[model samples]
Target: MFGGVTIGEFARLTHLSVRTLRRYHESGLLAPATVDPDSGYRYYTADQIPTAQVIHQLRELDVPLADVAKILATEDAEERAGLAGEHLRRLEAELARTRAAVLSLRRLLRPHDDTLRVELRKIAARTVAGIEDVVAQDDVLSWYDEAMAELDAAIESRPLGPPGGRYANELFTDGRGTVLVYRPVADPPVRGRVHPVHLPPSELAVVVHPGPHDDIGVTYGRLGAWVVDHALAVDGPVHETYLVGPRDTPDPAAWRTEIGWPVFRLAVTDVMPGKNPGQTGNPPP
Candidate 1:
């Protein structure tokens, strides 16, 4: 081996454990320059020190082993840099989410009035430009961003009202279902996935969920409890109005999402003998 160094000496030079170096060698991530077939000992050359250092830096960034292999296997400088750039972008997004979570936790730890204000309102039927799809739960966030972008690009004008979405219960309970996102617009131009459609009028038990959606589920639970207490629950999809959202402001505290649950007054006799009085007994999709 050129400028030969034993495995132990190489590990010391790289500031990595001998065991870790061995593991990396077995994974083909950082193989030594030479191996003694008789003694099963690994040897490294001084020239391989930079490679070891690069591998260590990548592992510190939590890049997957497979990705590390891909990066090392590519000899093109631009391709290697592109792979690292892509991973850095993912790390930035994860950091943003972590910061948002910390902010949400601070609010949850503080004491304040926990009361929820709900209103009963009739929403008139209206025509909208939108897109509908059966999206997997895991893909919802990215799908929503693309769908909204398409809608925004197609309209080329301000929407008449805040954007809204209809979520079928199966989307949550079964992990995959239909989702419709729309912007209220008059005579919107149909382009790409954007098309004109009419929404039905319905009475909704609505409540405002403030702050980042990280804890919006808590608001949903509170609203459901309020519906059951008021005997106004019904069978239908959930609706959401993004009054002030990520697109509106960077401050989580300024964000507002209106959660609407379908409801109708139930008579004493209308209550099923064995079923929940607040339930409409609509079958799940």
Candidate 2:
């Protein structure tokens, strides 16, 4: 009203809708310079055009309404810039996630050979320095990192073999279960969460998964299918040997993980009923 402009005229001048102006007034983000008591009309001055434009720009960036209000209420120019910068960082993170998802989806849609080279191995039992916890699936990454750091610090010397872990089936199926990370040591010092534990020997159907772990599930699926086809799968926890992981190398292409599933040989009768070739009903010694 100071500039003799109605709400409609201000809306056109600011390139903002009347509805948005009404909302900004109600939200206390921007109030008109005057309101007619008799006609219940809203009026704005020329000074508010810049304020309305700023609000429109902030909202266009998808900034939350509360944050927008905070930015407007702040008197310090640096504080206002910081608030906007924080939201920009969040948007950048989201964009990164979107890019990763797109790459994964492209790989999934493109058909490629699912055949993986697998091996049968018998591992001997050994005592290892280890940590076990019931962890949620979402927290597994950070939990693993911390657990590995603890084990590295506790062990005085290098590991006897590659770092490995055992994951209970329920962990994958139920999204929360037991996970054990271990490093083999000749004589490991037991301190803190690190303790000496015996790992049992077992026959395993092992397969190597190369590259990053983002799509390792596809390799696991193929390996499980192989085990089922051979009728060698047993009810036991899955073992993982990190041959070349993030700690070993920064290049994901060079990473190699050995996935082991406990298995047992099928009996002759089970393989071919009533047609035995003098084979014993036990795994090869």
Q: What TM-score would each prediction reach against the true structure?
A: 0.72, 0.67
Per-residue lDDT tens digits of candidate 2, residues 1-285? 344589999989998999999999998889998898888788898888989999999888899899999999998999999998998888887876676566567666778664567777799999999999999987887799999999999999878999999999989999998999999999977899999989999888889988887677777877877777656756589999999999999999999999999988665236544543343322232
Off by over 4 Å in 1: 1-13, 26-28, 32-47, 60-67, 77-113, 268-285
Q: Pick the candidate with the highest TM-score.
A: 1
Full-model lDDT, candidate 1: 0.84
Q: Model 2, stretches more than 4 Å misplaced? A: 1-63, 68-104, 267-285
**Ten residues in sequence with the least summed lDDT for candidate 1:** 276-285
Global CA lDDT computed for model 2: 0.85
Question: For residue 169, what is the lDDT in candidate 1?
Answer: 91
Q: Could you give candidate 1's per-residue lDDT for residues 140-177 as a string of tens digits? A: 88899999999988987778999999998999999999
